[model samples]
Target: MLPTEKDAGSASMSQVSTSTERANQADVAYGRLKQLILDGTLPAGAQMLEQEAATRLEMSRTPVREAMVRLRQEGMVEIRPRHGMRVLPISASDMAEIYAVLTALEGTAAELVAQRGITPRQLAQLRGAVADMQTALERSDLKAWAAADEQFHLHLVRLSGNSRLIQMVGQLWDQAHRARMLTLQLRPTPSNSVKEHADLVDAIAAGDGPRARKVHEDHRRRAGTMLVDLLDRLGLNQL
Candidate 1:
């Protein structure tokens, strides 16, 4: 079930307090809505009633609408004439495009990390993220695992220290996150993911850009292919 806007708003408020809190509120709304859609809480083709969302989030229609706009831009939601907003169906072609962009960005990060020599501190952070993911996986906590996975990649991008690359990758990361959640939910093989992540980390730590890039590319391609196959089996491909 999607969280009520009130619940989301209250949670946000508890975490952030300031005059500039509106921006934070909007971000929270956007992330929560996006996660709901990705996790199938707001299943594909489900109408996004603004009033209901506002009521649930404990926020006004304005912020909910703003969130919808962002989701629309991310290809996770669509607005129809007289029909209201609907969660967009995931498509294989869209998945392909997203993975393509992600591959490029990750490859660039790998090269940069090797060229610049990632700091030991940054590597420690990366290792710590992997440990968190492992713990999440061991406990069968899909959400925590997913969050940790994202943090790991985002940390790598930050290590690259390229503002433009980080910004572009951030967008791609958001799209990829939704797809990843879907994939993990369908398959739920925590052990495999842990091993793959560990191997990638090892390559990165060794400063082997080519190896690291190859491992990352292979992992993504395999995961994407698995997700497409799962969607096909579930008859979600028609979407």
Candidate 2:
């Protein structure tokens, strides 16, 4: 017997759902693997085996492989022929370039937030992130400070109310985490938020788009320049 039109449509929908689920799983795998690299759980030049990563992540190898492919595309890892993937070692130039891109994306976010004006709930979240940064700094916890710094920028970008920008910036930020580790090691106080974020937050609160954007952009550029200088002074810029 021939299936009804509704049955055929349902079958197609089922296929689509299955495909989406697989994609979601791949995303999860990608995030987990990236975090490992970013946190130096899998440091630069570290090799990651597909089967091993799958076991560690408690997921199937299929999604892990897919995640590896995506990470390679993002330059986070390099796929070796018949060998485990290697985490790419970033250089000073790489950090500068990354900060440049972040500046643009987050600069736009600042503009958007200024234009739209942040709500009270969002404002509270931003304030909390700032306070967290201050606390981490006082304790000399660079790691916690880094985490709080991430949260503050993340909050600003998220408060922009642009989902696309949020996703794009988030991915780039993940890759930059490796560079950030180096930065923190070289400089004990590695945070733009400690100084720059406050002014930008104030600009945002005042609904000043141009001021916020300018402040954010300047902060990013300064950070980029500092990273380059640090690497150059340490004779690592060429390496």
Candidate 3:
């Protein structure tokens, strides 16, 4: 029997709706699982089967499987044929490597922003982040300080107007998040770091590309060295 055009159209729409729903579900699963890992709820070296992940996420195996594939690609997890996924831990060596790449990428981002010139609104946003960091430190709230610090760097990268740089730096930041949070209290007070951020902001506002690059790169290199040294001294081979 030949189907009517209406019937074919309806069937096609239904297929499209179903596909969209599945993709949304996969995205939800991916975000939830990644957050769990980042917050240490899942913890490093944790392993679970496909069914377990589905059950925990309150979804079907299909979407959970799709999410696992993404995490695997991001170096956040490893999927075994039948073992589901294992959360990969970051070691001190991994920190060194991640930071090295971050230094170069973020330095270029700063230079670009300075060379191109930023708007007053954009400059205010960076200043606001620095102010927040200062307030957080004054209150002895390390967590809040960390959040503001992340925002400052995030704004720096975004101001570069380079999509690739933003994406790459974002991924590396996520990879280093757990380790940095874990070692926050162990590191020295961040007074100098805050000042450095302010200095970088000044360079950007003044359109001093070379100074901005040098300030940002030097800050990043020092931070990376300190973090790696802290991790090694504490014998945290795997974070």
Candidate 4:
């Protein structure tokens, strides 16, 4: 016998609920995978297996595929027909270009914030991130330190209140996440780096635009130089 109209409607509603639940699961999977990539758990040049990731994330293959597609769109993963997805390693070339772009973008953000001068609340946000980094360093929590470092820079950009700047810088930041982790691991972070953050904060607090720009520019370029030197030493001259 054919199903009644109410039964058909109930079946359709169930399908819709299942579809929505799967989409939510995919979002969760994507967020978790992205964090793993950023914090170095899924180190650069790693291979991502759909089955394995789905198992690890406790999600179905459909949601895992959804996550993988999003990552590919962001240039974080490459989908090979037979070989599966490979997490692209940040090459020397990638590092050089990323740093150059970030320096210019972040410098502009700093200048904007400084020119307008930050409110006390903004100052507190910046200081809070810097302080978290200092604490992470003292505790030898490299992962936490790296996270705080990103937050400090992002907070700086957000302070500018320019949505476009925030979006642009954020995308670049994500692309360079692996390189930044490698840099943090291979190089000895100078004590002055923390001091430098304080300097930038002070410049913004004082509404000194040029000083803010110069400080941020110098810091980013210095970091880029260090990472490139490391890559050269490791014979990875083209990334």
The numbered model that scores best in TM-score is 3
Error of 2 at 155 (Å): 0.8
C-alpha lDDT score of every prediction, in listed order: 0.77, 0.85, 0.95, 0.85
* Model 2 CA lDDT for position 40: 81
lDDT top scorer? 3
- As a TM-score, model 4 comes out at 0.81
Candidate 1 clash pair list: 4-56, 4-57, 5-56, 5-57, 5-58, 6-56, 6-57, 6-58
- Which sections of candidate 1 miss by over 4 Å? 1-25, 81-84, 135-144, 188-192
Candidate 1 weakest lDDT stretch, 10 residues: 15-24
TM-score of each: 0.74, 0.86, 0.97, 0.81
Q: Global lDDT for candidate 4? A: 0.85
lDDT of 3 by residue, 1-239 (tens): 89999999999999999999999999999999999998889888999899999998999999999999999998999999999999999999999999999999999999999999999999999999999999999999999999999999999999999999999998899899999998988999888978999999999999999999999999999999999999999999998
Residue-pair clashes per candidate: 8, 0, 0, 4
Which candidate, 3 or 4, would have the higher lDDT against the true structure? 3
Query: Better model by lDDT, 2 or 3?
Result: 3
lDDT tens digits by residue: candidate 4, 151-206:
99988998888998898887789988777666666677556678889999999999
**Model 2 over residues 102-186: C-alpha lDDT tens digits?**
9999999999998998888888888888888889988989888888888888889988899999988987888777777766867
- Candidate 1 residues 1-239, lDDT tens each? 99999999998887776535767677878878877876678877789688777777888777678888888886778977555579877576677777778887887787677667877898888889999999998898888988898888888888888999998888777666665666666774657777887887788878788888888778877767776667777766634
What clash pairs does model 3 have? none
Judged by whole-model lDDT over C-alpha atoms, candidate 2 comes out at: 0.85
**Lowest summed lDDT over 10 consecutive residues: which window, candidate 2?**
185-194
